[model samples]
Target: LTTMALVPQVRDAVDLPVVAAGGIADSRQLVAAFALGACGAQVGTCLLVSEECPIHENYKAAVLKAKDSGTVVTGRIGGTPVRILKNPMAKTYIAKEKEGADKLELEEFTLGALRRAVFEGDVKSGSLMAGQVAGMLHEVRPLRAILEELCGGCRGVLERMEKEGF
Candidate 1:
């Protein structure tokens, strides 16, 4: 669904699987989505730590180091509010919010530098695009382990619910 209204509409409009995409982080979300009639989920930020993820080690480190509020939603300068890791670029933009016409274009280049740092391992610059869930990941592990943990957590929750007579 492109927006909230389309979520349920798409879920009911067809019989095929409905995979929730935005803001998904962990097993709880998967279950909640299922409860909402979604058949599956498409994870992005949650997989940044996966061994199979092509992002640089520094990128994953940034994800691991992120706090619950480490990411900021920005994009008004361009268009939409994109969720990105709180980097120097974002910091500068936020600080310049009041400077108005005094803002320098050089600040925008910080994001590009962040890209170089994350994707190319050049920590001196480049911004990493991540979601709020980046804070939930504290370590880098094999993709297999991530999936195993996800499935195991799901099973545990299901077992708990069953024990509760649900």
Candidate 2:
């Protein structure tokens, strides 16, 4: 389930804290998660462009170049859906899926695709895993800067809410 849709439902169903994931990158998202009853937000794709991410430059470049429409959910052929950038590798996988490739064939095709993209900088033949928020990311900034922006954005949002009465 997507973050916004799932977080509240889970939060209401149980009394445990809910940590929302997927499509959460900025402070605005963080605030929205809390407003929707999430106790915290788990951020991943946004960090791919951070200086500390350790992914290949090619992977980072692909993510930086992505727009909201840049990502596609692949791996359906293997019965596991994954969101990744729309690169040559993803296109091939998608085409194969359309041709009714079996799960084993799909697995074989994607074997080492992630490693190639993450370590070998093979964007054309690699799996560039990312999220919808990849479009919001423009530059590779330090982790410190990213944290600061998120926190600052959250604080600003809270202040605005307080002034506007909730």
Candidate 3:
């Protein structure tokens, strides 16, 4: 289910407070989660570009350049889905996976991929793992700035939504 659908359902299903996660980037998503019965929202992708984020500089560049459709999930065929920024390695891996390549062949693509991305800044073949929200990340800002904008904008967003009859 979409976050919009699942958040409310999960909240209704359990008595505990629900925190919406996945693809949460901006104020609209934050407030929408609360409206959908989520008490909070978790963010991951937006922080990947933060100044304090320890990812390689080249990897950060790729994320900053991402378009809305720049991410893809691999290992779906093996029941271990992972989302990463689309690179030559990711494209070829997905193609091979869909063509029913052997497990060992698939492992060849993944082994050491993340290490390459994180340590070597190898954007060509490394696994530049990021969420689908990578496209929304434009610049590298300090952690404090990112969070302040994210949290501080919620009231304005809520006001706008209310005006729009949400």
lDDT value, residue 21 of candidate 3: 88
C-alpha TM-score for every candidate: 0.75, 0.93, 0.91
lDDT (tens digit, per residue) of candidate 1 on 93-142: 65655355232553554536656855696643456778877878888888
| Top-lDDT structure, candidate number | 2
lDDT of 1 at 1: 27
Ranking by TM-score: 2, 3, 1
Q: With candidate 1 superimposed using the best TM-score fit, by how many Å does residue 40's alpha carbon deviate from the native? A: 1.5
On the 0 to 100 scale, the lDDT of residue 106 in model 3 is 94
Q: Residue 106: error of model 2 in Å? A: 0.4
Colliding pairs, model 3: none
Model 1 misplacement above 4 A? 1-17, 95-114, 122-124
Cα lDDT over the full model 1:
0.71
Better of 2 and 3 by lDDT: 2
* Pairs in steric clash, model 1: 113-125, 113-126, 114-125, 114-126, 114-127, 115-126, 115-127, 117-122
> Which candidate, 1 or 3, has the higher lDDT?
3
Q: Give residue 87's error in model 1 in angstroms.
A: 1.3
Off by over 4 Å in 3: 102-104
